[model samples]
Target: MKKLTNFTILSLFFFSGIMSSCKKDILETIPNDRVSSAIYWRTESDAIYGVNSVYSALDAVNLFVLDGVSDIGHTNTTFTVEFNIENGTYDASHSRIQTEWQNGFRGIFLANDVLANIDKITTTNTALLDRLKAETRVLRAYYYLKLTGLYGDVPLITNPITAAEGLSIARTSQADVYEFISTELAAASSALPASYPTAEKGRITKGAALALKARAHLWSGDFAQAAEAAKAVIDLNVYGLVDEYGKLFTYAMENSKEVVFDKQFLAGTLTHNSFAYMGPYSQRNSSSNFVPTKALADLYTMKNGKEITDPDAGFDPMQPYLNRDPRMRYTMYLDGDPLPSGILFKPVPGQGGADEVGKTQYNTSTGYSLKKYVVAEDLQTPGASGLNFILLRYAEVLLTYAEAKIELNQLDASVYDAINAIRTRPDVGLPELQAGLSQDELRKIVRRERTIELAFEGWRLFDIRRWKIGEQVMRGPVYGITYFENGNPVTIEVPSVTRVFDPAKHYIWPVPQKETALNPALGQNPGW
Candidate 1:
């Protein structure tokens, strides 16, 4: 899909202003200087632009920063708001908490505006109109899915409301919100095409809707429904695992078969600074804002699919990087690993490299740097990274199906097939999971696969929440890589702070204080 250009953004802003304007005298001459709904939303271009505007709210920065709040990743920059979340010190008034709420609603409002005004266009192509409405509904549902995932219960506003009504709106139950999302996605899936042309690659598809529905149901613990939804996506047969796991993230391989849906970007146009935040300090010439934790590294199984802690796994503490999962190298840069710039990544303290821990302000706190999504071009200009951030992928859908089936206790052949497909992907080539395993055993395998397969992709935090394992994983000291020091291996504490994940209050975020303060009807979450 082509990135939204400056012209499209300017046009969207113009239409947004017109949509927000109050009713004017109908008898008076329509002013050319301003556009109103009466004069707008009357063309194909109008509908397309309106829907495209809603896509802008998929903020790359906010989505990518989510990993920092999970066990897999850590935010090293203490000056940033996400660092507070990493340490579990954020509150209702936290800036990131407030923006997540505001941004979600902003997307919902844009979608609602499109849905409310789309009929104004008089087109004989009923198919086109239905597709546009379907797209808008899916987008709106996505925003609600995100909101409810974090906030538990949010005001489910499907229509454009007056300022007075907005101030008085009350929070809706999470169950009802999820039900609405499921219904919308199911209906939208039928109207959307199974695939789009290369020119329209990033547009939402039937698979996207089904994948999201599966995610929502799984998160809600509706295992049977989640499995069914995921199965529907698989049955479509329109997506498959990309041959090269790492290439799936590159600009050259974006919109590949593995990607069900992704946020689009183009260099010098709609871009983000992910490279600057996640890349090695040596390459980006800046401090890495986010770094992987040892907890994440420890999750990667040995090449033979044995746990690294296994006595037979042949893990060498002196050479920790050897004989580990290939994905570990693909996902993160360890000491002595060659970087994209062909320089060895040396994060050991006093190594005199920019990425060396404690070497300078522009150093990694965790002794490791992210390798995923760190394109070579982005390192040259770290602020303008055009790499598309994948929102949904076929691998995730497969894992969701396998997990839901395991939770449902179905234990069918399809479950093994789903997981083995990812395990034995061409580049990964890990040992296939054997069949006839007990449900509890399969459950552990699938969860571990999710952690390693989707690391640094912003799914760990949600997995921690949905699995109710926050207290176990989130409350502890975060550690970095183990390195040999004078013939002894020593694991260093990354941030020198103990994380606190209070199950009583940390499971769900409190309603942002600004929102609750503005609208008293929006009550605080429990134990906030």
Candidate 2:
């Protein structure tokens, strides 16, 4: 698959008239790079460039690091409010929360800009024009999805608006925003192709539109719509799980059949510091901002498909990391694990002949490092990781279908097949799910499958909130494993920090105070 280039992004700005100085008409303090509709959109290329800028609004770095706000991972630094969000200290003033709000609106504005002006381009190819419009609409709906998901009932700006007009628009209800997203995605999927050529691999596809539709519906608790959309993508038969479960996250096999949608990044031009944030600080000058917690590690069942709580499951506390799910090994770095860089990890660092966590402030607070999305090469090259942050994939589609079916009391052989496909993928092949389970039983199985399958991929945070399990998990002390002593692992559960999640307030993030100040009509969420 070909990577998106910075050259096109540069030309996008040029054609959009960012290079030309704009005369400030009544608008005071004109944005230096604001798009001027009167000066651009003269050709198909101009429309393409405008849409490309819309695509640029998504930041892979933000998507990945936001997982740190979830229970599976913890952020070490206080620079961002991720830790504060986790510990229940975050509010409307958090810069990260504000950035999430602003970035989504920025993308919405760019997408609307393209949609409002694409007809000005003289294109004989009606298909091209329709597809471009579909693409922009899909992207616009996506921005709305992000906005409403993060901040409930955000301002719905469907068209490019003047500065004065933007200041007065009130927040739209979440249901209305989701309704618009569903309508747009239905249109986009009809117009989009199932696949693109290698050079155009990152472009949105029919599968991506449906998959995102499934996601939007699932998030909104519309089980039937979510299941229908996900099953549609599955029936298309263009996507499947990668043979190696780990390869789904690596740069070598990017744009594989499993990847439905991803944010493309180039190694030298637009790389992320995921390794720096997620790797062990002892190796590769890692920042250790997002480290795995023992609570997450314990979520993976034993290879025999028995939970640690199961009486028959042979789980040893002394050697906690052994005989667990194969994905546990792939997704997290445990004590004494052999790293890809050819060194054995020491749990306590300096003591026990292991790498010391105290070597720098950028060390893991939980004594564990993230393995997914942080390849060995990323550690070797510092910031040269080009691994695309997968936004949607075939496994997620399958899981979404399974969850929706289970929730609707419609679990059947097809639901089993959907989950078993994910379980039986190569290298992580666990036992197939048995048939004739109760609806509640199947629901538990589906939820556990989602937790293990999508760990550290930025899904857990939303999953907990949607399932109404935030108070159950987030209002207690989080634990991590103790280091080795007397040549054996202590296996003690070291209390890290107690997290609080008020069921009423934490369920929805507060609308940024700045936003509410600018437009008082944009009322805050309850209990903010």
Candidate 3:
């Protein structure tokens, strides 16, 4: 996939004529290195570059570090955005809230800019032009999806707007925003190809549009529409799960067939610090800011697909890591587990272990570090991992289909097949769920499957909110691992931190304070 270079982004910003200056002389001056819209949109290359700039927003850390705010993941640092959100201490003035809002609108503005100017190019290839427009629409819908998902009702801006117009725009209802997203995706799906050439691998596709549509509907509680859209992607027969569950996150599997859509990154150019934030201190010599909580580890069922709380599950507190779901190891590094860098992860306090808690400020606070998406080579240099983050994959689509069916009380064979496909993947191979289960039973099973299958992929926060389980799961003392101390097993609660979630307001984040301040017409969320 071709990413937008820094220079290209600057060029696009200049061509859009969106940058403002306080001084009239500065506003009138043009840099020799920048091109105006009149000359920039005269070629086919310009159209492609303009659309590519929109993909840059997809790489925002706010999108990927979302699990830190949920019960499953914990953010250690007190100053970071995830910390504020996780602790319920964040307000409308939070930097991340503002950055997320601005980034989402920036993506929308870039996509709208391309849509408004792509026709200016003198291209004989009408098919390419249509595909580009479809791609831009998909990206625009994606931004709106993130915005409305986080802020409830956000302004739905589909066209490039002047500063004066942006100042007074009121918030659109979430329902209407989703309706527009669905309409755009439905139209884009038809114009997009099922697959792109290798050189254009990460470009948005028909499956991406349909899969996003399914997610949008699922989030909005439109089970039937969500199921229909997810099934459309499945029926396309263009995607399947990769053989190795763990390898799917590695750089080696960047081109996996399971990926419906992903954000592309180059090692030295556009990259993220995910490895440094999630890897063991011994592996990266950096603080593990985001680590898996004990609650997440306990969510995985035993090898027989029974919850540990079940009497027949044969779970031992002392031997918790043994006889559990294979994904538990694949997703996180437990005590005594060997890391990719060939270091034993022994986070026992006062044991002099490299990852031991309180050994150093850089050690894992949760006594466990994330194993998924941590490339050993990337550990050599923090924030330089080129591994593409899978935004939407086949597993999510399958699980979404199952959950939608379960929600609609349509417990059929296809639901079982969809869930079983992921459970029976060659590397996972957990026991297949039995048929003829009640809708409620299937719902529980599918929810658990989605949680374990997609852990740390930034969906848990939204899942809890949409399922209305925020009050049940979000408040409590967060815990870490169970380790033996002088022959006695002990579970450690993360110290000096309290978790709180008010069902009334925590379900949806507040609109950015700066935004509401600038445009009072954009009212605040109910409890914010």
Candidate 4:
């Protein structure tokens, strides 16, 4: 909560590699090629610039925060790329994750510098300085959360040190790392304003800080703390699940009550920085690589309010998406629905590009592709959407609270309220919580709702990890239904390892070999 006085955040920005891409209009004429404290953090404008640099770093887009943890990397269940037996030439696994492990650490290191140096600024207004510090802390906490989740344990560096000092530091245990994350967020939550004024409405708020704390604790398996943190956020009552489910994803409906923290994307200034930016709307829509699987799609319970895993799980898998969670409709563009911007999709005759030979490939198998994060109103825009990516939201908090409550085995009145709030959303029409259900049963229900509600907001990666259900869920020959020209479905197969990983090693990714080599001080996780 202390104000950054003599310390200039802009100095830290220059020292750390200048990698900001958030709001383009607010530019300071700081020479990017040079590193000078006198020239950099001298003006109040410089401080704001520094803060945006931090936001840009923390924001999910410009930096790929959870590249390793998400489905695209390892920990995927049911979708794997098979090794080419004939190719003695090339071998690939999730090595990109290990190679790029520094991205998370780089963000953390920059945040640490900003946080440490903010107090040194002498002429800055006390209130403005504190706000910048708090925002940096929240963003730092986010980077740390991603780090801890992926590696389980990582070096916890609060104060910035020289490269030599950093190299000698060993990794901290996950427990300790999360403790620091919680502590930092708690401080940030208290320091940040209850709400930023209209001009800064989108900035991190006390609620956003607390909401993030709640989720951080939830992911670390600290259920009691998670519940308490979640309670603190709910007490704020500033946010709620959007009345309509689809509104959460579209650009027109950004920064709603449901949105707690998100990466803001605009039409012109900033590129559509989410996974959607890569989505190909037409024939060559190959960039929608970030696809949801059948496991995710099937996890959503039928509107009749029955889970797919239920005794009467009588719904058809062939017509797999029918009567499932309404979120499926909002999230992915399936075979029957019209494409975004009013493009009607006809079934491609074959995998070959004969119909539209050179068009883009939005290869949505079984006629499904991602619609989330694509800006709808920007239909006339020159290129893709500018939808801001939300980092934290009340809906995820609600579910986190529900899951924490269930995990603690105290499904009392408070628990029911949180669960029911989401369950009875206009799209998800399920019966109210039943009495006398076991804790595990409630946990199952919580998990089901998470898959349906928070599917592609980058929640599932941590969700699967926290539940420790990777072994059960991520293994075996995963399958997806690819629709043919006649609307008939053909089963396309993915390799076993792609979908599954060895359970023990799967929960934690291999520590970057480069990191371990450089820092003999660090200890590797069990398997890797």
Candidate 5:
């Protein structure tokens, strides 16, 4: 698949999956030292460089077809005004989703070009032959999954077809997309290594393909199938939760048991380590993009406390975060001494204040900001710590199994044990589940556990969608306090969630304006 082509990177977008092309992207990123797509793939060395180019696309920005944007989702979670949808302040032309959409398709096309061309060329190194192809397929599948999930009914392109074919294709149903991913992942699982070589340890693995299948089935609501797929990796027994929940993402990255797949980042280099960028905007720091919302904050259950959702607990939802789930503290940036970052991010403990612009601002009105993915200790220009962005972890598979079993109404002692194993982690703050609880009770517990366990790993958006509550919860009140120092409490009312997600449209991003303006054959998503 090292063959360069006549097409640009976007040609890979619809290719086979999301990452259709690989080599062209590298040439473009390296500046004017241009390599025409039509000339390349000279030897094994060429293949190695070509594959490395493919790996280059897995950065924070490109990954946003899945992770929420740098500014909005990050800031929106905090109810911070980094990007405002209410004021029609959306930079639709430059949204990360748009970038993701374009990048994903570009990748798909590139993957197709490489995969199709590799077989045509002759190479004697049979050892690395299957390795490169296997990883490419895995990557293609990964990008397609991202695109399909974001914009339901995306065009399912399996090969690098001509411009005539590309321009006229219609959106395929999500069911078909899921089927494609399921099948591709299954095939790649066999071809891929259970783990990568030492130099290749960071690349795709058999475990990753299997885990992807598990997640795909989970999202598709194939609980029984999802459980079966997830159990395969769970049974492999190679992965388990990290001893400390907070250490899953670290400079050296200690927690690997559950991290099946991740985008590795090396600090002190020209790499994409955005812990500083995405984290809270503290006086001690710069800015916190994604904050934990009151709605999500409330997901944390209280310790030895009665249930608020229940009728007789005298539950005051106002004090939701207090005495609630331990995951709350780990997942959110709360008002405290030394937070998850451990750098003493006490932005507004007792004193409320204004910014340099003289407008009042507050640290998470719900007393919560994102702390999960923020690498707190590393703050030096090479300033932040090195950390890999975990794509899939064992904790998710465990929970997926538990949740699926619960849904199947066949949950047993093992299910509870699996869940408690995670709950028991010191990094995670919650206690064990109530013994012998009904399936319904188990359901509530799992939901709460997932909120704190996987809070900021880019799961909330999908969780809300799969749970089918995106409209209600995402459109509800994003609670916050705008404390100003006039000795008067300056409460800033956050606009409702309604502004962000339009029920009819706004699910998948609108096709990039340029694409539509050029291709008359292309149709926009329903709401667009």
Candidate 6:
């Protein structure tokens, strides 16, 4: 990723000028102090800053914490909007819901500003100009993807429009919105470079555009397009899975070859507090958040490539954490795991330790802390790590290809090779899938592999939604490891917050009431 410089400073000004908390229709006007199109979009540097400012809208907190809204996890804080969301108490009026709507459009507006004005800049470097334009278009498509994924249909504001004009635009059908995104991404993929130099790293590449196209097609159930798009990314050969899964999340691996697109961060200038959010209670200066439920913990397979419930797997409940997949220890903060403090993470009751889990102040309810993105050395500093939030990576491309093949009922040698590449990764060292499975069998395997591989990286919510299984897994008791009694792990079942996923309404968020009131043309979603 590029270092902090004029881009960071100018992005702050851009955000201050355009960001608003009111309804999307009337509150999206650009402030007078902001860089207006008339005078500001005349130079290459101006064009550069315009696109960089749009990247500021990508927040790690919102993107990464989305998994908690699914079955596998929950936000640590109670009585909050996220908690309400997990428990199915959220409505159109939730502040976070409104923020999602506002932020998604805010990014879109900024990208539109760049696209509308960049063409006016006098640049002899046509290649750079095309790349910049392609990058902006891909970002706009990404924001639209987020919007349509959360809200079934949304207002498709493609150009820079006045706030007054926006008030009269009605919602576009989700099919149309997705079609627009697909078209934009396809154009972007052609113009973008296959990769970028280190100095210009973290910019969108052709592979990222293709990967997103595959994601859109996959979610829309267009298996053929998804498979073809994913294959295009694979053919690029510019990216591959990192040698080790754990290294992919470290500061050393920022902008690594595996990352197609990421939210870049600099230590002193543009750092986020995700480590603090993912840390244990004692490690945190205040409240700890983002604990994993047992549902997630149990998804890891045995080292021998067998599920714990399989009778042939030699499962033992007394020593449940032992002999599990190597990825589990790297991904989760389990009891008896080594800590940076030269002690093990002992979450047993009355352990009098930082890792203790229970009803105490700042304690974890699920008896687990996220270790995937947490830097062990940064535990003392809490919110000081500059780890980048990886939005798209090569691993996802592989999984998308494998799943698309399975869905197409073309399960062949290529499908096995893709899934095995991840499973038998040098760091993982797990056994591969056996040969010659039926389409139905491989479909289950591929989905489970995605669950275990991408556990807390915030892809689970969309996966369940797209799979149409929200009611089955999301609406139930959220279980967690409680305490070890007589050397056996006891699972805690909390009845206070059983989730309820109403298939009728919970599949997509409702348009905020404030927006609907300000613009009567904007209608509410079903069962709001």
Which candidate wins on lDDT? 1
Q: Compare candidates 2 and 5 on TM-score and give the better one.
A: 2
The lDDT, on a scale of 0 to 1, for candidate 3 is 0.84
Q: Estimate each model's TM-score.
A: 0.96, 0.93, 0.95, 0.83, 0.80, 0.94
| TM-score-based ranking | 1, 3, 6, 2, 4, 5
Give the per-residue lDDT digits (tens) of candidate 4, residues 1-528: 111211223444455654332343557554557564544555566666666666655454423223223442222212322121111111223454453357677777767766766666677388888888888888888888887876787888888788799789988888888888899899888888767544555677899889889988888788999999888889987878778887777755676788888765455545454444334346233344444455655666776778776879667756766877687777766655665546564433354522221133334432345566654465455244566677788878888898898988888888878988887887666668867778988888888777667666666767778877766765554444454445565554433334435665667666767777788788677755
Candidate 1 local distance difference test against the native:
0.85
**For residues 1-528, what per-residue lDDT tens digits would candidate 1 score against the true structure?**
455444346555766557454556778665676567667788887788778877878757666688877888888777788878878889999999999899999999888988988998998988988998998899899999999999999998988999999899999999999999999999999999998877777778999999999999999999999999999999999999998886777888877889998888878877788887778878847557788899999998888999989999998888888877788888988898887678889988766765788777657888988887887767678888888889989999999999999998999999999999998888888899888899999999999999989888877888999999998899788899888778788788965678888899898999999988889999999998
- Candidate 6's residue-wise lDDT over 361-447, tens digit each? 466777777787677656666676677788988888899999999999998899999999999989899998888899988998899
Query: Model 2 lDDT vs. the true structure?
Result: 0.79
**Candidate 5, which ten residues in sequence have the lowest lDDT sum?**
1-10
Pairs of residues clashing in candidate 3: none
Alpha-carbon deviation at 268 in model 1, angstroms: 1.8
Q: Which candidate comes out best when scored by TM-score?
A: 1
- Report lDDT per candidate: 0.85, 0.79, 0.84, 0.64, 0.61, 0.81
Q: Among all windows of ten consecutive residues in candidate 3, which has the lowest summed lDDT?
A: 15-24
RMSD of 1: 1.8
Candidate 4, after superposition: displacement of residue 277 in Å? Answer: 5.0
Q: Please, what are the lDDT tens digits per residue for candidate 3 over residues 313-354?
A: 999888898889899989988888877678789998867888
- Arrange candidates, best lDDT first: 1, 3, 6, 2, 4, 5
What's model 4's overall lDDT? 0.64
